[model samples]
Target: MKPIVRVVRTGTANLASVVASLRRVDAEPVLCADPALLRAADRVVLPGVGALGAAMGTLQGDLGDALRARVEAGRPTLAICLGLQLLLEGSDESPGVPALGLVPGRARRFDGDALRVPQLGWNRVEPDAGCRLLEPGYAYFAHSFYLPDAPEGWAVARTTHGVTYTSALERGPVLACQFHPELSGAWGLGLLARWLEA
Candidate 1:
């Protein structure tokens, strides 16, 4: 059977694009809000956009607990952009707003004259030795907040906008990206294929 991927729809702006990306990989996409469906999914995708505080508010109570439990189980999981931000300890985007804390560190707004906030458009991601899934290429990025100090072992890929920042985090079955592979072109599709095949 084709893989069943559950997408967490917590009102992220780019949820549709992520679902389309999964379909491009030949995976069955299931739009999910309930924790039970998330726990039962073959793979889980947490894709988001918009304000961190609002996203957190949308995922409170049982939904948050279920997501944490799934992460703890180390199931195949993927988070993108704001979705990636939500996994951190917290974000400067909204002070005192608690995140899922699945990944260590905090998300901070981009600060530099060389580039504008939201770091729009494509940026190249340099992958680590273990990141066979991601080739050195530009991926679509559209976020201002980034995880500047991720846990030592979780960063699997790095990208530079003005300053160096994490592009991807990989630990066990959990993989998250700061860029949108769906928006990215053929290389992005190839990267998604690698993840799906794994």
Candidate 2:
């Protein structure tokens, strides 16, 4: 079946970057800014950048409503970077905005209070052997904020910059990743391709 991935343009989200990445894997994707077209999509990719409060606000405003509907219908959704952060209940970055409430947890900044803030550079992402999207090697990460602990059994993968932290999360059919697979080389591209194939 041909996949129709909807790219959400909300808050500080970057849709073009996601489009470029999906195209490299031959995934036929489309930018769905309109709520009508977005709701009609088969599968959607929720990718983003920028702060949590503003990002979550945009999601909650309009895009989030459409996403919640799509997810409730059992459609496939992929959340990357800040997009993943939007799935949580709240983020310390902006508690006022309120997250999607999909996962029972809060996102926080990595200020090296235990690890390092703005974890820049290569780090190993050890998948739990159950993560089908994992490439069995290190995936590049460039973020200052991430989910510390993903509730009980939600976390699927982790990474270590200075200390071990949750890097990937899975709840139901939604797969959210904190790193940029598109910039992580062949392994990353392979992961994107795998997700598309799945």
List the RMSD of every prediction in angstroms: 1.4, 2.3
Per-residue lDDT for 50-148 in model 2, tens only? 888777766665667788776656567788888778887888888687888876778877764666578877788887766666656777777777788
Clashes of each: 0, 1
* Shift of residue 128 alpha carbon in model 1, Å: 1.4
List runs of model 1 lying over 4 Å from the truth. Answer: none
- Once superposed on the true structure, which residue ranges of model 2 sit more than 4 Å away at CA? 113-116, 153-155, 171-173
> What lDDT does each candidate get?
0.84, 0.75
Candidate 1: tens digits of C-alpha lDDT, residues 1-198? 878888888975667778888888899888889888887777888888889999999889888888888878877888888888888889989998999988888988899777798799988889888765667898999999888754776647889877898888877667888898889988788877777766
Clashing pairs in 1: none
Per-residue lDDT value at 180 in model 1: 89
Residue 108 miss distance in model 2 (angstroms): 1.2
